[model samples]
Target: MPKKRGKKYTEAAKKVEAALAANGDGGLAPEEACKIVKATSTSKFDATVEAHIRLGVDPRHAEQMVRGSVVLPNGTGKKVRVAVFATGDKVREAQDAG
Candidate 1:
């Protein structure tokens, strides 16, 4: 099969790319990125980016954080567990299907 080219980079993604490039070899670490995100980006979703950036998290890490939190392969460091509550049947269905 022919390898397909990826979709065109998004304008926002381009901006991020340029910003990183401009920072050069000693570019922004995750923590620094998060700080910049916190200082500039103002949407609710951006907060996750900010936190990741501040923690020196990588782009993929930032993406995962924004996508939604998840358990790590190693699992939570503790043996404790918690229950999740759903507000409605739809949410329950989504949880089950997911």
Candidate 2:
């Protein structure tokens, strides 16, 4: 068996292990995992959860590579502005918006 950790570390580890076991052998679905993460979080402020995906494409091969951009249905939390170059009405609209 491994040596015992400090009190805080031991408590944190127990919470993590309990969370994992609560999900069971077949494993938790994405939504279930998110719930468990939220429930187990100790932060005072709201925490954002993210998932990382690894694709099976080889970066060395140009044909196997994928590149694209997507606009989220709900925009990012940060504020953004668009710049336009035009004459007359369009310019007036852009200036007013800016």
Candidate 3:
């Protein structure tokens, strides 16, 4: 139990604390507190750190995704190719957007 808690919590706590503090004062009312946090903490990505925890992934995996190495793992069995299709003018947009 200690091993599980130690490995998971140690990696997650600092980032979570910083994110919460950046969101708003932790003492505020629940609804108001959540609203401030949500409004302040928007990322362009569809997924978020909290969602990863709710989905039961280890925080180390989350850190890898944040650091961009998770998407490009050399040891993964399959190589992935991403495709984008658009009108003639949108090719540059696709690359820029990624």
Candidate 4:
């Protein structure tokens, strides 16, 4: 026998299904996706948005592996602090840059 979802789980599933129905299972523009996410958020705290991408490269072969980093256009919603250890010119450059 299959287990049944509780009332809360069922209600949440309905909400998700409704959202999916309203927004068809097609590729959405970034702005449109953000709007949908914000409208559906039911928490007092800010919600997190994530993306999962599948690349056409083989990971087993070291030569075919890919690595890179990107800076988000709007910046991540987190604070970062920089710490540097240096002497003379490097220390002066860091202090001046700050």
Model 3 earns a TM-score of 0.21
Q: Each model's TM-score? A: 0.28, 0.47, 0.21, 0.41
In order, candidate lDDTs are: 0.60, 0.75, 0.57, 0.75
- In model 2, the Cα lDDT at residue 93 comes to 88
Question: For each candidate, how many residue pairs have backbone atoms clashing (under 3 Å)?
Answer: 7, 0, 0, 0
At residue 7, candidate 4 shows an lDDT of 76
Worst 10-residue lDDT window for candidate 4 reads 25-34
Give the local distance difference test score of model 1: 0.60
For candidate 2, lDDT tens digit of each residue in 1-98? 98966776677667767867886763556776676677667679987878755576898999998899999897888888676879989888888788
Residue 10, model 4: lDDT of 70
On TM-score, the leading prediction is 2
Judge candidate 1 at residue 18 and give its lDDT: 75
lDDT, candidate 3, 46-65, per-residue tens: 54433212333565675634
lDDT of 4: 0.75
For candidate 1, write residues 1-98 as lDDT tens digits: 96654344344455567778888875677766765555555355734431323445565664645345877898867886546666778677867765
Off by over 4 Å in 1: 1-9, 29-32, 35-47, 50-98
